[model samples]
Target: MIKGIYETHVNVRNLENSNHFYEKVLGLAHAYGQPERGNSFYWIGGERHAMLGLWEKEPAQVQRQHFAFHISLEDMKHAVEYLENKGIATRNFHDDDTGELYVFGWMPAVSVYFTDPDGHSLEFIAVLPDEAKPELGLIPWSEWERMHGRGV
Candidate 1:
């Protein structure tokens, strides 16, 4: 049976830029690289936990992708600023740079999104320790706290 996502891949136009973005900006450790083959590999959430593959391809050949990385709730709370300070713009689920984390109430998870050098959509998310509220759909974290009768 499947356990969790072990790896995911995305296409980038320039392997160097993508590597710098994933390694320096995102802090994913380099796992391997094949410069002649235009492929790069990185480790996420530490070695052997998860992997991300970046393959350099022609602009017309690249197919953009969207993926998320699991993090702790505390990190999710500061993700926006953390990214923005690194010169990456974080956006809401609506694709707006509102500097806020939205909760998918159904799973009661918090997520914030940003894009890589290749414009591939990437997200940092964490599951909240609360009951599911599917009816709530997607809402800001402040709203979720208020609904639970607590101050944000």
Candidate 2:
């Protein structure tokens, strides 16, 4: 039986650059890697736990993929600010027509989306408690917070 994902691998044009991004931007620790094979590994949870691997490839052909990292609500907020300060764009999918930086009310979570160096769609998500979950439709984080008296 499958317990959980142990690791995920993706190809990158430059291992060094991807390493820098994963380490500095995403704050993932660099785990041991096979330099001869042009591959680098990063610890997603812990030093020897869940991981993400970057394989160096010439003419890197990366298909856009979506993945999310579980985080606390506070961390999700901080992550959005950190990315914004770094000039990285973020997006959220809500029921309303207006585009925003966070998705809330639906999925019982708040998420902030951005792209990696290889154009992979990444998200930092914080799952909310059952009592706090909405019945339907997505709303902006700001709106959800305002309605719940959480404030920005």
Candidate 3:
């Protein structure tokens, strides 16, 4: 009976730098760590909702990955500014530093993308309460709202 992802691991070039990014910048709680073991754990969305493990590895050994954190639509609306204000540049799924949200009509979800200090892609996303429109593929948030007749 799987309700959600419990944990995910990532390889980082510098453990302390990654820890600062996760713990200070992003505000994830430090669950625990073993510097001698070259790893640390962080709690996301609170102590038990999800956990993230960081493994310190050689830069060449690190492989970047992408993941998203679910947030409310209200928060999603201002995610770009929130992250940018914190000095994290946001982007669209296209990898462009558009500093705006993108909508995946198929899933009917809106998201803003950014990266960790290690260049691992990260996202803050929120699903919209609307019917799927697969034909729309991926589009700007404004277009999504317009098409959905909730134009803002």
Candidate 4:
């Protein structure tokens, strides 16, 4: 009944900081926004499509939310390293069997999770081809890249 996501809105403590994070760190282009309304808009995926709106609000009023951005498999790897170089930490789904964080095999996607300046949970996810299945259990991004014969 529903199509793809058209836009997403989230409250942020500061528009400037959020803008820098989204624009510089996440590589989203700034579309446009109303300065009077204390809001900023970013373009994701394509130009003038898949919008992400940031509304400036008080810290107490900012509600934490989770959202995942679809990225290329190679880009996902670079994103993880990029975040690490910037001193940002990432996490994956916890695997009880291996006692480590691993990717979700069912969806065949490798994801790295982190938080925004406003404490909203965000993820960079790369969905792989259906044939890319693991033999034993969920694997890490490194393992996924290695199995596909591509990595840094």
C-alpha local distance difference test of each model: 0.87, 0.77, 0.89, 0.80
The 10 consecutive residues of candidate 1 with the worst lDDT sum are 93-102
Candidate 2 lDDT, 10-44, residue by residue in tens: 88887888898889877899888898999998898
Q: List pairs with backbone clashes in candidate 2.
A: none
Candidate ranking (TM-score, best to worst): 1, 3, 2, 4
Q: Total backbone clashes of model 3? A: 0
TM-score of each: 0.94, 0.83, 0.92, 0.81
Worst 10 residues of 4 by lDDT: 94-103
Worst 10 residues of 3 by lDDT: 93-102
Cα-based lDDT at residue 82, candidate 1: 90
lDDT of 1 by residue, 93-134 (tens): 887656556889999998888888887888888998899999
Q: What order do candidates take by lDDT, descending?
A: 3, 1, 4, 2
Evaluation by lDDT, superior candidate among 1 and 4: 1
Highest lDDT, which number?
A: 3
- Please give the distance, in angstroms, between residue 73's alpha carbon in candidate 3 and its true position after superposition: 0.8
Which scores higher on lDDT, 2 or 4? 4
Q: Assess the local accuracy of residue 70 in candidate 1 as a C-alpha lDDT between 0 and 100.
A: 91
TM-score of 1: 0.94
